[model samples]
Target: MGELDRAIADYDQIIELNPRGPSVYFYRGIVNARKDDHDRAVADYTQAMQLAHQDQRGSGDRKAQLQGQADDPAYASSADGQSIALASGDGIALRARGGAYAAKGDFDRAIADYDEAIRLNPRDKEAISARGNAYKTKGDFDRAIADYDQAAQLDARDARVYFHRARVYWQMASLAKSLTDLDQAIQLNPKNAYPVLWREIVARRSDQLSEAAKQLDATKWPAPIINLFLGTMTPEQVRSAADDADPVKKKGQVCEANFYVAERALQSGAKEEALKLFDLAAADCPKTFIEKQAADVELGLLRASR
Candidate 1:
């Protein structure tokens, strides 16, 4: 077992021995969260919070020899001596639960948890980012953008925030702004393929085709992205392009050739090949709006034939 797993097991044992031990529950929750068992983590945090609240109602300073009350002034101030404040652990747990719910596609619940987490700790960037992702999943792009903005401001070093904002911009059809954010994302993490692929696609669709093409060529665009474009090219043209000395350059030419092939197929009743290319393009450039549009066209044709 991992250290986190062992820690969680130890917490379980401690909790079993002392049901009202808020610290034990809190630590267990943290361990469970680290293990990605967010539901159980949430439960542990809630239990810790409840127990913590119950310990806070003492009339005057009274000491509890047990539960490690010596370090807590609030516990010492309580008359019954049973009271202790729940640490920031509850907030941490709520944030974790929100992220887990978001990952599971329960955006509404995730947002609710994030709301509570933010209420407890307003400056929690992780919670804010998780909420933003939930908002994006719900198609509330404006709210997502707002949260992502806050997250970026708070954690400027996080490339993911820029990447997410770029996605929102793309959704809103603010292509230039999207491209800008995508460029930042790529700058921060060159190995990330998403921004590079999407950026290239947006560049292709840009009104200033020559400038966009220049930028794309300068970037040394990936072969898969070039292949996706070439899937739309004409078969003969693709064959001729493949004869080029540089395979990388050939890929771009092939992409253009495939585009023509796919386009001509669509025009000449070769629906099958056209659909295949469309599917290929979508797979290679999922973030491209045009691929989705082409997918819609292919789907429409298929539906009509049925």
Candidate 2:
């Protein structure tokens, strides 16, 4: 957390030096969002958008002036190049702000920003995938799938795109399709922990528990948390492992530990205990963490079913 604070302080000095610089604001927004300071993130993102628009308008004026001097082909070409670069930068700013809005749970605004970002840069796979996430959060699975498909077509080797698509399939209960996408994602990025974790989860959910166990046992994970999924370590041990000297790391680990314990309780038919554990994970975990998102999803599904 202190590292994030120091980074923000550095961005503050940069902003002070060049108040009109949009990129600094955008980066600061990301750092603030990661720190779970949603309001500050929104403020920085808003500033970034404002400055980016100002830059775009200035670039447009310059391009118009150069067009009036079309006799100078070199001037016109230079203006065109500048305009294209400015447009791309603006698209990036919009996408960054959209992510901040999504983190704040303002899906409508987030989608609007993403739409403009795509319009400005049609081949932006990152923006496409992010828009898909916004649609997924809104329960518009069809649109989410379409966006994910587009992103995959744009960048077939992007493991995150496949992972996002697999998540949507999982939500729709298309377990086989989900598994297929997960397999592709893992094949593309074998060392990525997210795909490995989700693959195990999908396998377990599909009643392929033994297969899940075998796969988990065969693979060496980067995080000790994988032991929880493999059933080699008890939930109590998982919680104990979270007892770290660093408060932030300890909080994150505890959140993950609670989530794994909740999954274990749910698998053992202890719904009440699982719900309690999910509550603890949700309450303690930072919103930026995948564990928090998973816990929220589990809690929502549990309540919906009840």
After superposition, candidate 2 runs with Cα above 4 Å error: 55-57, 60-87, 205-222, 243-251, 286-290, 300-306
lDDT, candidates in the order shown: 0.58, 0.72
Q: Candidate 1's error at 142, in angstroms?
A: 0.9
Flag regions of model 1 displaced more than 4 Å. Answer: 1-8, 23-38, 55-89, 191-194, 197-306
Q: Write the per-residue lDDT of candidate 1 for residues 227-257, one digit (tens) a residue.
A: 4443443365344644555543454344434
* Candidate 1 weakest ten by summed lDDT: 77-86
TM-score of each: 0.52, 0.78
Model 2, 178-297: lDDT tens digits are 999998987887666667777777777533333434443343322455666666777787788777876766787788888878877887889999999999998888654556767888
